[model samples]
Target chain A: MSTIPEDLSYTKEHEWVAGLDDGRTVTVGVTAYAAEQLGDVVYVQVPEVGAAVTAGDAVGEVESTKSVSDIFAPVTGEVVEVNAAVVDDPSLVNSDPYGEGWLFRVQIGEEPEDLLTSAEYTSLTTAES
Target chain B: MSRSTPLREVHEALGATLTDFAGWLMPLRYGSESVEHNAVRTAAGLFDLSHMGEIFVTGPQAGEALDYALVGWLSALDTGRARYTMIVDGNGHVLDDLIVYRLAPEEFLVVANAGNYPMVARELTERAGSYDARVEDRSESFALVAVQGPKSAEILAKLTEADLDGLKYYAGLPATVAGFEALIARTGYTGEDGFELFVRNEDAVPLWNALSEAGAGLGLLPAGLSARDTLRLEAGMPLYGNELTEEQTPFDAGLGRVVRLDKPGDFVGRAALAERAAQPDQEDGPGADALRLVGLVARGRRVPRHGYPVTRDGVVVGEVTSGAPSQSLGKPIAMAYVSRSAVEAGGLTVDIRGSHEPVDVVDLPFYRRSK
Candidate 1:
């Protein structure tokens, strides 16, 4: 089982959104459950910083040994930062999906919609598994 | 629900990610697939290959019957030796690539891929009806476990007294491994010195456990199909569904070496293969002449996965059959069939999604084990 951080909000596509202290910026990464399901991630492609993305847009991709999955944007926002560390070592996504493996930081444009709480996300993951 | 192998519980106990492969629920990976792939190259990796088919051809004229049933001249094959051969249809279209072990003067063990074994068994039965041979599907009665790597010999030597040092590649023998009856063969898909142990279905778990305990200090990890695939890709070996298929002949896949045209005696696909061989080069023709299997080394991080288009300039010239990030080479390598002209012209690129990633033409078997 993977850890579902109580402080973070999750999307149906298995991305976690961490609201920053500034309230305008939020860090996003694949949930640990998603990372675990993907096995060993060999490569990660993230959207360019400063690019505007709409909610549900496939902003990036995570390639594992067996398959690949699109990393979708949970909310409409401008990409503020991308994690070069995860790009350099894709295994970090499997190791620390919520912390050091955070894929990108987005400056919120419109308020996030329909994000699931930790309890709800846990239920979703449990049901899927 | 997909069928489970005898070692299914063992995989679940180890937290393996299971997937349906050829209708069998097999382990795709355990933890990190990269780690397992690297282990096979550097140390050792255990594989549960019970899902593979084990068909027995035995009787007074088994070898003669096999000679007619398969492309190889099996009657001449020495007992205890295994030959890498293929079974093709009447049109020379490959059915499945196989490894046939001549166990005795009148008995052979035919190991077929999981998905195609049933068809192979049926084909063998039909083809051998005129000869004094019997084909039996013993897949359910047997289990296969392979220990592959540089350290495989030493690890296996500790358990059995069966002269691991003298067991030549592609040879098998009946032996007692950890007190269990097993037919240990020095063969594997991974390009490493290894042994594949064939045991009874009930002995699968015990054999795996004994090997695991013995291989622990030697860095043997339980590798799954995901790593197995990458390792074979690095070795430039073809998978049944990807590279070799019923739609293509051996010559089309550049695996004509396994087809024994010189072998005396009429075999299945012999006539069609001979006709194809005698024909003039079809350089301008669309069939067989257009595609030639070749290796591609990506210049970038993006991998050239199966079915990705291979192009030169702007025209699509070929398609990738198998590809992966090679742990040994530290770059993505692939086996693709490119047009002979595009191959000679030299600027080949694989369309990675929408981005055209430049790939340098290279030789197959990206990694070879040191003898």
Candidate 2:
């Protein structure tokens, strides 16, 4: 029953990307399907601001009660901002995976390729479940 | 397709998350596992344990056969009582942990883990060839439901007219529950006061419904295997595939107290266990430095899950057996087998994925109910 917002792009790894209106940066977080599969999120590790990352690189980690998963970079860029609120209370990932649970904002260095549209992501999650 | 318990439909009706456990379709959680766990801690929680195996051993030689087959002195175990014991191979490796209930002077009921019970029944049948006992697998005929927590007795008292006060821990008696016959045992694995009802398969739904109604006023929730795992982990109980297995003996798992060497008659694994006990404490040798089960508490929220390596000074010394987020302690806790040398050195860390997280060694049983 997870809703995939039409405005956001997604990764096969279950991460969702919201491109900011400025077009220079994007906010990233895990999809609601990922959060539901994880049951409860207890800890989140976000890359420090100013760290350089390439697309598809593992930049952070999400630790749930029973399991742990890595957060991959959606675009080749430098981390511009990290969400301290999500780090303080990780349950936001389960409660609001697409909103306040955003992990970090990255300044896009190269336009990402191979990102799935919302419809495709929806189909992928449906096939998986 | 996996096997379904008699209560499977009822669980589906409640919208429980079903998962495959030991080839059986069992409920993993009703809703939120943490909510069920907390309910068991603060009040009481009901569990559908029909997946467990029940084997009946009856005849005049039932007690004698059990004593020779297992590690405990079942012949001396008083009637209407139950004892926790283990079945081991000739090499002293544990096959399964069992709870044997002496229901009558010549009858005994052996309850075993669902995954290991078929093997247990086969082993019992093979071992009892010379005795006058008859082993029958009654697993299909029975459905088990347990109400566990501090308020378990209070909830159960409303359904049955049986004397709840007289039933001691581990004692079971035939009682009428919700107008159906049940063998009510005052036993549980959640480190709380509870009752396990063994009823016919046809009575499972009615019994569960009756208990649900009686427990509504009190804080009884339907719990699943996920919550049960955490509850037992906090109680420092050893799980079969985790803390125990054929690769390790009861002594290696710090459960030597359950082995009865002075119980007169010869039992399986007695010779090997005696030889093991007589060996000198040799450092780094299989005699004494095999492994010691210890508790590990995470300094942070990253849990040390099963098969995670436990390290000391960057050297892998042990592996985590069972771990979870302890609702009562508000932290992640685990049981691991640390080598003697690493344990003595003090500083320990759990390799969570690739990152080594600092951990503190603590005593087992992170949570204990106040009697």
Q: What's the TM-score of chain A alone for every prediction?
A: 0.97, 0.97
lDDT of 2: 0.91
Estimate the lDDT of model 1. Answer: 0.91
Writing each residue's lDDT as its tens digit, candidate 1 over B1-371 gives 89998999999999999999999999999878999999999999999999999999999999988989998888899999999999999999999999999999989999999999999999999999999999999998999999999999999998898987778999999999998999999999999989999999999999999999999999999999999999999888899999998888888887777778898889999999888776566212245337888889999888899999998887899999888888889988899888888888888889988889999988777988888
Off by over 4 Å in 2: A20-22, B280-288
Candidate 2: tens digits of C-alpha lDDT, residues B75-119: 999999999999999998899999999999999999999998999
Give the runs in model 1 whose Cα sits over 4 Å from its true position. Answer: A20-22, B280-289
Deviation in Å, model 2, residue B168 alpha carbon: 1.3
State how far residue B317 of model 2 sits from its true place (Å).
Answer: 1.5
Output the TM-score of candidate 2. Answer: 0.96
